[model samples]
Target: MSDFVTPVLLMQTLAAVREAGRIITEAWEKPRSIKYKGPIDLVTETDVAVETFLGKRLREILPEANVLGEEGSPAARPEGTTWIIDPVDGTTNFAHSIPQCGISLALWRNDTVEMGIVYLPAEDELFHAVRGEGAFLNGKEISVTDESDVEHALVATGFPYSIREDIDIVMQNLRAVLMTTQGVRRFGSAATDLAYTACGRFDAYYEIRLKPWDLAAGWLLVEEAGGKVTLYDGVTPFDFGKGILASNGKVHKAVAALITDTDD
Candidate 1:
């Protein structure tokens, strides 16, 4: 792996995600055609259109890297760099014109994420992070909140599309969190929630069974913003396939214990 992320590389990656934002923005302006990927999952013409644009743009930006996009893209290049892209994070919301969706992108290399960018086109908010440079919002530096009291913390969360099969589990966790934290929010977009947590809009965020594209960018943003991210156990490392617990470091352990407490 390279020792550092170059400025050119960062700029190009940011441009690709932003271009993706522009694509979604333009698509949102016109009539929208929506489709269902499953009973609860949604797909839109804009999702495919933006994915195609991102697939091409990202490869052009980093020819050496492979792409894994949510909308029918190829598998990742395991040995080299990989760009993970979620063309539209909240397709249902986008289809409903709810303006809660965004594009999520992340770059992975040598078993670690090097950069992440989440763009909410409707809101014109761009949240980005370089591994060591800290997180930013539309070029302005941002940080996680310092709230340590779980009862006073505002946390965000989402129900995964897999909720159909895991409704009970989702509900159990939701109930636990609702009682433990000051409040809970369901924003329909895990990527957006994580960005909000990174920027101190929310003190913590957690969710289960999310895809790589959904968690990759957001996880990096939280970490770079001086937050802690881990599995529900708070000791296990966070990966896309498992449940996640992210907080502003101060409340991380308390939240994790609550979420992972079996007797609750």
Candidate 2:
């Protein structure tokens, strides 16, 4: 693994994600052709269009790197250098005319994330992190909050699509956090929530049932910003199957304890 990522490659990936965000935002502004993958899971024409655009762009720049996107790619584990993307992070919000969505992109080399970018087109905020390098937001260095007390921290979280089918588990977890934290928010986009946490806008975040495309980029960003990311049991947050618990290092243990207590 190389110790440095060229600014050119980073810029290229950022541009691609930005371009994809623009395409999704444009489609979002107008009426969209929507489809259902399941009862609550949604897919929009823009989702496919953006993924195609991103896959093609990334391939042009890093042809050897495998691409895994939310709308495309096989179920194979990413090998060598792989780019995992979520063209539109909040498809549910996009379909409903809410502007709280963005694009997420991450490059993994040898099973570890080398770089990641999250772009919020509506806000024009770009969050990025390169391995061994610090995290940034709009070219300015950013860091996690110093808040250590879980009771004083503002936390964010999300419910999985299985909430309807597993309502009891979801509600119990939600209630646990709500009663413990100073504040709680559910933004429908795990990428954005994690990005926000990295920049100190949120002190911590946790959720169950997320995909690689959902947390790949944001995980690197949070860690680079001096935050902690792991499962509710305090394990590394690399599993695509289980959910995650992330905080600014200070409150991680407290948050993990709360989550596990809720489970118990």
Candidate 3:
């Protein structure tokens, strides 16, 4: 892909995402009114409001780009250049007044993610990266760790919402990692976990059955930060709603081997 994206466009897109953060922050100040989209799945008014705000502002920034968001706007898979977004990545955490959730946005040019921005409103943290241009946190550059040993590396992971169907695989992988790594953490937000991995805060992150919006932006961040992201098998390209394995490249192969099921 050519370096067609302009600085003005990135500036405008960041402004829109920050606006979404502002909306989320405003909603956080009030008593949360939570609604259930499934038995354990959640959707909050803040999610809808932020998505709506983002949709409007982003379209203004790129009129030619289509929008695909988690909150039900433009439900179909995007065609051509599009924007993939998750208004609130950790609805359950936010509902409990936990501050681990954030907004995720990425620019998709056909199959490749061209730009990504993940904003945590609670902490005022903004992570963004453009294709081929390295990753950044609040304008400062960032990179993944060089740690090569899984025994000393800190790892992060998440459970699929349909735990009943995937619990066996989840626990098996968790057990393997917990047995070998420095420790493991489940922070409830895939975006944040991936972003943290990009900045060397976490050496790696893995999860299954995640939607595109969950990791779209963060995936770009990790790759641009000198890390690698792939499917669990370690060779396939990770896609929407699939299992993902990301690491600092040093421990990737070793970690993938540990997590993979030989029977499967």
Report the C-alpha displacement of residue 45, candidate 2, in angstroms.
Answer: 0.7
Global fold similarity of model 1 (TM-score):
0.94
Give per-residue CA lDDT, model 1, range 148-190, as digits (tens). Answer: 8899999898887778887777788788889988999999998
- After superposition, which runs of candidate 3 have C-alpha atoms over 4 Å from their true positions? 74-76, 261-263
Which one is best on TM-score?
3
- Among residues 3 or more apart in sequence or in different chains, the pairs in candidate 1 whose N, CA or C atoms overlap within 3 Å are none
lDDT, candidate 1, equals 0.85
Off by over 4 Å in 2: 1-4, 235-237, 261-264
Instruction: Write the residue-wise lDDT of candidate 2 on 41-96 in tens digits.
Output: 89899889989999999999998888988989766456678899888898998888
Sorted on lDDT, best first, the list reads 3, 2, 1
* Model 1 lDDT-worst window of ten: 255-264
**What TM-score, over all chains together, does every model reach?**
0.94, 0.95, 0.96
| TM-score for candidate 2 | 0.95
User: What tens-digit string does per-residue lDDT give for candidate 3 at 59-116?
Assistant: 8889999889998764646568989989999989888777889999999995899999
> Candidate 1 — number of clashing residue pairs?
0
